[model samples]
Target: MQYGAQRVSDINLSQVRKMFEQASPTAINLALGEPDFDTPKHIIDALKNALDEGYTHYSQNKGEVKLRETIVDKLKKDNNINTTADNVILTVGASEALYSTVNALIDPKDDVLIPDPGFLSYREVVKIAGANPVALKTSAENGFNTTLDDVENTVTENTKAMIINSPANPTGSVMPKDEIKAIAEFADENDIIIISDEIYEKIIYDKKHYSFQAYTDNAVTINGFSKAYAMTGLRVGYLSACSEIIDEVLKVHQYNVACIDTATQIAATEALTGPQQCVSDMTSEFRKRRDLVVDSLYDMGVECIRPDGAFYVFFKQDNPDEFIQKALKEDVVLVNGNAFGEMGEGYIRLSYAQSYENLQTAMERLAKIA
Candidate 1:
């Protein structure tokens, strides 16, 4: 008897996790995109205080009122998105927010536009929702930003939604403000709902993040404290949209995860309302690491675009599979670009979220093969 559903069987484990698990014990990991920083003292203290103050119980299904209110202000001030707590749903993480939004809005056989060589979850989530994920292929020559032409060429009458990620995963490319507004306008005109992933917004260097909802009312914005606050384990994230959309997504959130826990919500509220120096410091350090990786690759005559944000460098190679094998042999683990999507072939993504000393050593090791 078949035990698993066809959708479950169709999806394989992500290659990013596969490589990380299979790498040699001695290998320097540049595979996962997780930040190496510890959660800030203030946030940690808030969590402790919340637990001590009896905040261990279940929160509102949507989330704590304070955190939701803080997120509303954040959206207005930082993202230029005007929203209310009633239009927000706190989620398990950006992962759940993405999953819930896709499942709630996308119908079976509907087409969803996703960037090729984009976040791996975007395609998988759409597939899990029984939707067709149309690839909007981006190339290194174009700085890996999804363009108006790409959307125009690929979108069809069946296209119901699109996902856009700035300071994108694997490639670390950020979309320009003018381009963002243009795409948002086109999506609005075409009646395609935009799902904007801004998980990496605060990690950016020298680039500004433009929220899709800022330009269009028909949009869902997903963000979290994971990357920015190094709170991956806390599992706190949120989604904001018009009440019509949020109302539906809340149904999914209620069933999947009733609440994100009061302690974490209190801590997340602190993460937003407390001192922001921690965020600035982390971003400053990431910028230095990014430069080190880019310079090392350049010195080796490797081909790559200097990323404007995020902590990854997706460099081109002639034989990415063989290159990955050689890199593993050199005790420096890297992910093959094909893991992201078909357009990612012939590339390898290197994460620079490790210590400067470790990155220095990894660069030395990669130099031998480059």
Candidate 2:
């Protein structure tokens, strides 16, 4: 009676979404990942202007030329990645960028290395591509950043690719530059491709975000405006790689997405070329929220590392499932650590992307149960 394809028969809905859906309407949600900020005024104005200018049609399958060119300059100036417009593919969001890249490169039965407590999508996408996902177990002792040793322990002759996320989801740990370079060099030596998710690059605090592509030609960089510019609904993101990879990835993108919305692509152009004070201001505010949440958890006698980047605080709980249930009873929603991976079993991730006022209230509510 199942109508679904066998390829997706084993895939489950995101646990993050399940928590969000089951929470009471009055619950303080810390389960979702998107920033709480409204899209900046300038970008909103640009979207409106684009619509007025009749940009309602499909863009080139590669995305709007202007957006791609802007992304090219951004890669050079911000990421030190000297890629061209032809090497970029604008996707629906970083989600699409991740999916398309995995589908384009991974083959059935191939082994792909992913962080143990990594983003859920990485494992699901690899499975969807009919590949095996090898976990590179990271730990709190290591700030949850994947090390070269972690790579060495998990890699096999069947390993074809690896996915790395800095300022990683669930954990919010930013990988150090030296560690990233070490892994990049290791990948180079082994002839493995690297898929670096830098969607959180701009949300970093007290650290610089390094693009893996900067360390190796055998890397695909996935990023978007969703986190940085509060453009999640607009669904505009892009991937940059060598032209050869781009030529292949384009086939998956062209059929699956055709092109991103023309108006949103135009708006994305403005998000890059326009003033960036909005981005800095948002990061500064997130810094304040991050401190509040971390300090509050510590005050409640819970141990957790201060995240170097991103707006999440993954803290240890002896029974994360029980803790999550207790949190829900107190009207404060959180995601269980096990949702990320086996290594995440004793921890829970709390997103501080909400308003400072809301975070304060949520923390107070959590303190009641902690």
Candidate 3:
């Protein structure tokens, strides 16, 4: 059969979702990267109240006006990013926000730099956008932190953008502010756009998150309510960039998904402005889980950096694929590390989004492995 676009073929499937789908009734799941906590009750009530208030019409392509305004207010207050409503675009999720940004910026034959062992979706999205996905290697040796030198070596004349994640998925490693500043400066010097995915900004355990746009003007900051407010089902996220880039991405979004669900937008607005106590509470619990998981892994001779933020623990195993398989057989479903990228061969990602009881049970099972 004559195939679909070659770029379509290049998009690999997501290992995290696949592993999550196969989590048996008897399995202890640490494969998903969402909070186990319930969505803050007020946020849920806001959505219901919106529905009751006849908010069923299609919102503006960007999002509900109030939500966009809320994003502007929250960005300025939380991250020191002075984005206006014109500079923000809301999408179904951060995944869609990422897709829109990638599709908007990348051109045929251009190159995009993504961290090796980074978000599994980055490489595929770059390929599908018809850009070469260049992997910059990071390692457990340095707590999975990518250095400026590592980023510099990967840059080329054809390089159009770089995607960065703090409190990074799989590893939960927050990029240091100095490193983030250096990268922002480097991107500014090269006239490259930086795609900063800060979805876990509110879930940080040990350190504060510094926005890339705080250090430089050349960045698109992506964040969502899913990770922070346990609103994964709401499917609401947003991107903030300079107005010029926002205008460009808005076009791509208009052609794809015209707008996010109206109720979700209202709910997300409440999530940003309502009681932030839920965010603080869940993150504190995650910090406790981080300690428990890291301590357990160390006791089992599995070396890993204690993540200063986020709820994941990426650790080395004897043979990651084999270890994951065995763990599944033992009713502990963990994502295989290589699923993230080539540099993740001996590593496995453990999410502490599950209950402490579940995480402790999984850790005990892992420790008993021969």
Q: Which clashing pairs does model 1 show?
A: none
What value of lDDT does candidate 1 attain over all alpha carbons? 0.92
The deviation in Å at residue 270 for candidate 3 is 1.1
- Each prediction's Cα lDDT score? 0.92, 0.93, 0.88
RMSD of each: 0.8, 0.8, 1.2
C-alpha lDDT of candidate 3 relative to the true structure:
0.88
Winner by lDDT? 2
- How many steric clashes between backbone atoms does each model show? 0, 0, 0
lDDT of 3 by residue, 1-370 (tens): 9577776875778889899888788998889887889999999999999999988988999988888899888888889988788788999899999999999988978999998889988998888888899988888778888779889888988999999888788788888878988998999999999999999998886688889998888999999989899999989999999988998999999999999899878888888888888988988898889999999888887888899887888888878878888888889988888898888888888988899998888888988783
How many angstroms is residue 154 displaced in model 3 relative to the true structure, after the best TM-score fit?
1.3
lDDT of 2 by residue, 1-370 (tens): 9898898999878999999998999999999998999999999999999999999998899998888999999999998999899999999999999999999999997999998898999999999999999998999999999999999999999999999999799898999889989998998999899999999999999999888899898999999999999999999999999988898899999999799899999899999999999999999999999999999999999999999988899999988888899999999899988899988998898999999999999999999989
Error of 1 at 127 (Å): 0.8
Candidate 1 residues 18-83, lDDT tens each?
999988888899999999999999999999999999998888999988899999999999999998
Is 2 or 3 the stronger prediction by TM-score?
Answer: 2
